[model samples]
Target: MVTPVRVVIALCLLAPFVAMLWVGSYAKVDPVFIGIPFFYWYQMLWVPLSAALTVTAYKLWQRDRRGRVAAAPASSGASPKGGASE
Candidate 1:
């Protein structure tokens, strides 16, 4: 469980949760805020949150790839040009 991989999983989990919250809040029949409507804010808020979530996921994916590369083992065998029978 690399940190980056963990972060990616967290972000994937968070996006849907946040979206649900926004949807639920907007679903109220009246859907009003202090002055603005819940419907408007909920949708607008998600636009930025969606971008943030995407960026977070991308960053985490890159970090995970870096970790995998660092942990990769060296190749164990010679090339075919060596031409020897086993």
Candidate 2:
């Protein structure tokens, strides 16, 4: 069930977690940004970055799902509304 698209989607979803989990890498007061320390700015930076990555992952998953749905054979007996009709 694994595909390149899924792998990319996983990476997109995991990048922020990996970045934020490695706290030692950003635990520093140097490299201030307009008075904000690297530690604070770096964590804050991931807010938008995480959102972007999450969106990317979601889009990729959606594309992958669409591909699978298109490739699969349609069910002939299924009704559009799942309602019994005369």
Candidate 3:
């Protein structure tokens, strides 16, 4: 089942990859910021953006994992009583 939450998490993880891979989109020297060229600043910006996206994805994955574990049946922890049966 493709839940909306899974879709959102996928997008969160995909954002950084897509942004970094599309180099030509931001490969420009104009529109300098704080003496930094667009190309440099654009790549630098993704550092924090990637961090945020990774954190979001991590949280979503943890939540999904917890839900699955909670819904699953509990396993018996008891060991076999007989050591050597004749």
TM-score of each: 0.59, 0.84, 0.77
Q: Would you list the rank order by TM-score, best first?
A: 2, 3, 1
Score candidate 1 by lDDT.
Answer: 0.66
lDDT of 1 by residue, 1-86 (tens): 55747866687758757776766656653656667777777777777777777787778777776766565543524333333334
Model 2, 1-86: lDDT tens per residue?
88899899989988998999999999999999999999999999999999999999999888887776566556544333444334
Where model 1 places Cα greater than 4 Å from the true spot, the runs are 1-7, 10-22, 29-34, 76-86
- The Cα local distance difference test for each model comes to 0.66, 0.84, 0.83
Report residue 66 deviation for candidate 2 (angstroms): 0.7
- Among all windows of 10 consecutive residues in model 1, the one with the lowest summed lDDT is 76-85
Scanning candidate 3 in windows of ten residues, the lowest lDDT window is 77-86
lDDT of 3 by residue, 1-86 (tens): 68778999999999989999998999899999999999999999999999999899899988887776566554533223313333
